[model samples]
Target: MAKRCVPVTVRWSDMDAFGHVNNVQVLRLLEEVRVHAFEDLRDHGGPSLLESGVVVARHEVEYLAPLVWRLAPVPTDIWITAVGGASFEVGYEIYDAVDGAAGGGGGGPAAGGERTVYVRAATTCVAYDLATGAARRLSATEREVLESWTDEPVPFRRRSR
Candidate 1:
């Protein structure tokens, strides 16, 4: 499946005293992209993962480079890394798009330009029954929708051997 490229604006407040995006704010960026992904899936005639009730079970983030405040929105690529009975993993890469490489329709970075990645991360999301307040198995429709967005896992630098 093709990765979804979402352009995320970095707010001035997201910057820390160190003059770069705060580590905590990076998670918020991932959340924003994930929410957009779910909405995009629903817009494309797929089941609404958000409406069905999903929660983040885990998040692994690697800070590769400091992201300074910029006027242009950052290009972020997000895709499904894994899917299981009740959970799925979403991988993300936040990077700088050289030239005019803005992805308007889920396409990745533009060709012929070097890009600098700021972060690589993944989130594990679990299906849940909000009515019962318990984890639930993934439905066929949900699984199908997720599988359609599947891609390779994030290549983290400090992954366990």
Candidate 2:
């Protein structure tokens, strides 16, 4: 299947007292990505993805650094890392839109030149029937949409990889 990409924005509320994005918001950020993945999968979800039983089976996030940066504007970029039987994983990298680097990309005094900070996140989610509590597979149309959602080698350290 192809990778899916979604853009996410950092809201002022998303930041923390330290003047950075809060830890929990990253999960929400990842979820926003997954929601868009389903959106992509379902040809840009209208009501089904939400109406359907979607649940987060597991979530893991690696905070490379604190959310202590300021930005005039934010961009959105998230991906559907993988989709399994009734389950899927999502990944994201929120950074400065201008420089296009992860976590400043260097360890020297010149490192701070990057416009954005890289924060990689991965989450495992599941689709279930609310009434029956059974796993549900995405419909054919949805699969096609999901397959169209992203490019290859989605920046995720997946279980298979």
Instruction: Give lDDT tens digits, candidate 1, residues 1-161.
Output: 56989988889999999989999999998899999989999899887888889999999999999988777788899999999999999999998666543443536655776778899999999999989999999988888988988998798989755
Per-residue C-alpha lDDT of model 2 across residues 24-107, encoded as one tens digit per residue: 887777777666555554454433665687777776666666764344433445666675666666666665544442334444
Best by lDDT: 1
Report how far off residue 157 is in candidate 1 (Å): 1.4
Candidate 1 has what TM-score? 0.89
Candidate 2, residue 149: Cα displacement in angstroms equals: 3.0
lDDT of the candidates, in the order given: 0.88, 0.60
**lDDT at 79, model 2:** 61
TM-score of each: 0.89, 0.66
After superposing candidate 2 on the true structure, give the runs of residues whose Cα lies further than 4 Å from its correct spot: 1-7, 40-47, 69-73, 98-116, 150-161
For candidate 2, the TM-score is 0.66
